[model samples]
Target: MNVTQFIVDTYGAGTPLVSTAKRYRPSSTATKKGYILIFAHGTGFHKEHWEPIIERLYAHGGPVVEAWAIDAQTHGAAATLNRDAIDEPGFTYSSYHFAEACANLCKTHLNGTRHPIVLVGHSAGAASAALVPSFYGQSRTPPFSALILVEPAIWPGSMIGMADSLAYKLACVAIPRRRTTWRSRDAVRKDLGRRAPWGTWDKRILDLYVEHGFEEDKEGVSLRCNPVHETQPFINQINAVYPVAELDKLRKKVPVHLVYGERNDLFTREKQESLLRGRRFASVIRIPGAGHLVVQEAPDAVGDVLLSILGGLENQRYVEREYVL
Candidate 1:
């Protein structure tokens, strides 16, 4: 299958935002599937980071699938769409805004595809999925059939006013200090290989970051998602908080699955239990020996888990297999 890249313009809260997507169409008509899978990336990462997982999904096919991975506004190829937001340090994005863009993208581009969508997201994108169906208001039916969230960056209502606390303050100071330009891709990779989080990432994922996360410039390659846009979201996490009732409504509309890394500190047992308290169709599974970047560290493993879910969806059965790396 060939992967094609494209872009679509959409309005989010009346503001113009652009989203980029990569499509992998099925090779044979014999295995055509019922749903289109859409993948959304996390903060500071481009849609290309999903390539490894996409490749695995195709190789372990249960049905012919048309899959897409989208880049959020201010990330990847969509970064140039809003120069003002790219330049302004105070400009921040919200989950509702991102959700709106995703919805509009579907209406504009995937309208006649005749496929139920299986929404998959990681980190911040996962949070956006939680708010997509009810973006504008309450709706009886959603566009998606199921949702797979990986380590979503959801915060409690209590953290709404804590944006200016020590953590956000430190992120504000640290993100901008990151080096923006590199002499070459290898140079960028070498530099990143020495950093804590980046160094911990799988080599292929780190390569994708160096490949799609930067833009060519006369001086060298510069980060596409600059520090200003990246740090702004970190400090503005309060804007991402939504009523639990809204999420509950969405979960009732479709099957929602949560995938977390065993070593990830974000999803404590109490937090997971709280999230699954009243949601009957919601389930949780952990990937052992992984952290918040589990998808990156073990795309093949994650891809296997996703395929099982998709198979279940295709056969009208629910499979919540525990995946251990």
Candidate 2:
């Protein structure tokens, strides 16, 4: 697959800029009309984190014309680009910023593109994906043909104060005091490999994180995303439940699919079920032996699920065409 990197200035005057990586088969044409995937990563993760799953998708010969992974303003290369703004004393980040960025890409970079687009996201990225259609309002057509959310972080507004939840602890405790700098990438890798979350991640995903999730300086390599920025989205009380409302509005317009890890590490069963209440979805799947970080723990499984969803979509389209005929 050929990979190209670029940056997109988000919509709205003061919004932060974002970075993206576009991947496609070398033999594929720009004009090919197939599924175009736009991915958004969870808090504290970079765009390249999805590469392992994407490679599997291509290897399976799915009908993917191309895939684009986005870096939220505070994460990945976008963090480096927007350092000054992000470092501002009162600066804060939220899923809404990511939604604006994705929406902007659809309006500018993907405008008039013929391919059906699938918006895929994990955790906070899933919240942003759910909110993307809201930016277009009811009058305009949303860019996404479907959404595939993996371990979505969205919850009801009333659940924000659930301090016992792993998500809250991760945001308010673990992340705030976590080590962010190391003498070398090797050291960083070794350290994280022995830790709870990273230790559980697939080795390939961890390797990718070691390679692309940090920035090097004379002192050492530090996480590209600042801990403060990362924690903000998790604690953004008002924004935490914002996507649930968006999801309700979106369910009628596009097929919404949910992918979850069997373990209830970050979000409990009740939280996951809350997303399904009174809403219709195309499909819901859970990968065993994984937790909230399913993308990292089971990239191959994630890839398989994505391919299956795409296959179903393709078949549905064929059936619709036949019915029309």
Candidate 3:
């Protein structure tokens, strides 16, 4: 499947929250009939991780639909944002920057669109996308037409609260950092290709994984998904609380689609319900045998599910709108 890489250049000051992205458009073109989907990829990987799933959708789905995948700040091809590296003793990794990066993309690239826009995310990326409604609300950014979050890491605290924020900060610091080794890294790469406990995915989805996923020097090669910048704080309850409420408010403006992989260890059903239960225009989808990387684990099924959701949003005339103020 042929594709094109587009740079949704966005930067953040706190960490090396650099991001790059890719998009997959349908091969066949009609007068046009679908929504614009902005995809957020899982952590410890790059945007390319969702390439196969996006490609699969492009092949079988409507011309009315389009899909895209973005790297979290400091991961994938977004190496430039590494300027102010994380060097402090207590500082740690956080997905806070990912949310900021997503907001900037919607403001700079996705704003003023005529078609309905759906934000789709997986794992950490899903966590990032899941925050889109709230994040935009805090910043006065335009709201999306709908949202689709897959097994996001949004429920670290059971509820979105201070304890959750602190725990995430501490965990990013506490997790044992794996030292690099040429032999071990090669093994990790190999393992990533095989079927996960819940599902299967192509290893090639992460050739870009080679960059941050591997650390090289005199030591040769070692695993490297959680770079210092990746570990830096990107989400903060106190700092980003407005966005969370914005997400709630945006529910009044557009439909919100939430999806989860049944095998996902990250987001439980209770958490999924918590993320959208109060919202009027929200729907949750559960994929039977998928995991954190649902798109890769069940590319075909993921594609089909996305197509169906897109069709529903289109049928409802869920068009994207721009803010006048």
Best by lDDT: 2
Ranking by lDDT: 2, 1, 3
Candidate 1 lDDT (Cα, whole model)? 0.73
lDDT of 3 by residue, 1-325 (tens): 4456666544454443456666566666633656777777766566776666677666665534566677765565564444245334554444556767776776766666666677877766666675655553455544566777666555433455433334345545553353335655556566555534312554454444554456565666654444544443334433223335645656666676666777635344554555555555456788888755676667677878877887776677755455321
The residue ranges of model 3 lying beyond 4 angstroms of the native Cα positions read 8-11, 15-17, 27-31, 79-94, 133-141, 156-175, 179-188, 191-218, 222-224, 227-244, 276-281, 318-325
TM-score per candidate, in order?
0.86, 0.93, 0.74
Compare candidates 1 and 3 on TM-score and give the better one: 1
- Model 2 scores a TM of 0.93
Clashes of each: 1, 0, 17
Candidate 2 Cα misplacement greater than 4 A, ranges: 11-16, 26-33, 163-167, 318-325
RMSD of each: 5.2, 3.4, 4.9
Candidate models: Cα lDDT each = 0.73, 0.81, 0.59
Off by over 4 Å in 1: 27-30, 159-173, 266-274, 317-325
**lDDT value, residue 106 of candidate 3:** 69
Global CA lDDT computed for model 3: 0.59
lDDT per residue for candidate 1 within 229-260, as digits (tens), equals 67655667554466355677777767888888
